[model samples]
Target: MLKVIFLAAFAVGTVLADGELIILNNPGSVHFEGSQATNQSFLKEVFTVVLGYTPKLTQPWDGVEIRDPFLLPEALVSIVIEGVESVKSPRGKHFPLNVDEVEEVTWQAVSRRLEERDTNNTLVRIRVGDGLDALGQSALGELKPNSVDPASLKHLSLNNEEDQKFIEELQLLRAIAQKIPSTVTANSKPDVYWFVVSGLRPVMDLHGKDSEATKEALKLLNDAVNDLSNAFTDIYNGQVVVALFTNDANKLRNTRSVESPRVRREEKAGELETFDAAAQNSSDNLNTIEKPITLRLSKRYSANYPVIFNIFLWFGIVFFFSLLAICIAIAGMDPGRDSIIYRMTSNRMKKDN
Candidate 1:
């Protein structure tokens, strides 16, 4: 019954795919050449394990073509036991159950454990059995007992070795999938087609170089190309021609140059308006910058400044100083015999002083 419930959750397909594939390699932080192949089949498998089960195997199946395979068969058979329920054995019930009852009990345990996903009123907790840490090991070298620490989850580790093994197995599956060739007909088919299409109609990056990150950055690039290649032979696939390489050094210089123009315009904003009017007042300013003209010079020239007066400027400066000198002299004059006006002013000024 537990196996039946587990199998029901996953749907596996072993059909040959008419889809595109993309294989990316970033092993040890180094990229390698990308490959393309045609005519591949995709296989899916599913299984289940109890929470306490150990020594479980995860492996690949036989009688299938695995392209760029990354996993082995022996690893697949391991059982992955995820904790499904937190229950004290019923009526103090211990282990040693019959095969007929195993399925029903396993399912009951799973349903109980699954209750945690639905509970929203309070903080959810998982009972970590024993002293397992993040690396899935008990205190020292011993295995943790079948007990959960709901509060000490931070210190708790997954003791499920089967799950870890399965993850590694999945990587192998992905590698093999990359090696297979599939057809790309529509956007929903696969991502490999996009990568191939980008190669044909290359787009230049901002720095006038082929984009290094575009193939990796854009998801559609890979799907469109791989799928299209799979759909038809003789279509370009599996080739990574450089579309753009960012020149960081040149970009930095351009960023610095961008600031100068902004600064010049801001500083000259109001000052240039006055300068332009003065330049227009005198043709000499325009003459400074050489210009070709077809018009002949006239013998007669008009002087417009003859009507504008220069005398008022000089007279105004003189009058201002004269009034200032008079005020200072009067302020220094004696109060006794200056005049009646002085006397009246002196009397009032002295009283206020």
Candidate 2:
């Protein structure tokens, strides 16, 4: 059954997509290549765990063709996961300060540095599960369970073994979908939404690929992905963009698949391929990146005193300071050899005094 999410629109226009950002995790070690992610035939085989199955009639398919051909599959994680933040050098000195005194590290604050197009925070953050923190887990070994102490890093390590992580994650996303505002027609803030879902288990499983224990543990991954994809669509009505990828390293590798990223600003639902698992390592280039219909840039020059209006103001200040300095020097001028005030107020120094 398709679960529907309902929201009343306040504005009177055709409600459509402002855009959406979905971040889902897949196995780092899998190689899901050469899978038909076309809407016509995606269910032929198991790619990764799974997510919502989308209809292809409205959404066409395009595979992202990575230009490289000599990259190793296992190294895709390092290449595909966005590394703009981690690769940056930290502030020269580090002193733990109060929360407000510290810099804003939220996704919205870092969105610019992350190269996000929208800096207005229109992409509402939809955090599904709270275990490993940060919706965008850029690196592996981030498989940690939710902690009670908040500050305590030590907890039941996910070690990427728990199926419950993915299960609870899907559940939370479904529940959260019903709560957020999906009406993007109004000219308001929070125009878009963002969801980050990570499935770090199956591939990171300690057991070997053929091990029954691993298979039993990862059986539900497919169901989770399928359901989440559908639920978001049912709620948003296909007015979203989903870009699924494995690692940022994949971009550097010889991997590529074309995806139907939203280009013309149309309304509809679609699914990009999920994070490629080893068994069905199916990583296709989902086109969450859509070019804007129109782009206008407004520039603001940072100058305290422009040569235009403020120049006089600064010039006046400098002129007064210079005049005052000269006056002070004149007032302090010496005896009979100079001004009347100096002659009256000052006396010749006694010899050797």
User: Which one wins on TM-score?
Assistant: 2
RMSD of candidates 1 onward, in order:
37.4, 22.3
Task: Give, for candidate 1, the lowest lDDT window spanning 10 residues.
Answer: 188-197
Q: lDDT tens string, model 2, 1-353? A: 01111011101001321111122322222222332222101211111111111122122222222222221111000011121111111111111111110011122222332233335433344434444344444222223332323232122234444545644564454444333334333221113334444443333344444555444323433344445444444544443223332222212223211221111112122112232232132223221122211233222222232555477988899999999999999877664545566555556633453
Cα deviation at 251, candidate 1, in Å, is 43
The local lDDT score (0 to 100) that residue 263 gets in candidate 1 is: 14
> Candidate 2: lDDT over CA atoms?
0.30
Model 1 regions more than 4 Å off: 1-307, 346-353
Error of 1 at 6 (Å): 73
Q: Looking at candidate 1, what is the lDDT of residue 93?
A: 12
Model 1, backbone clash pairs (residues 3+ apart or across chains), number:
42
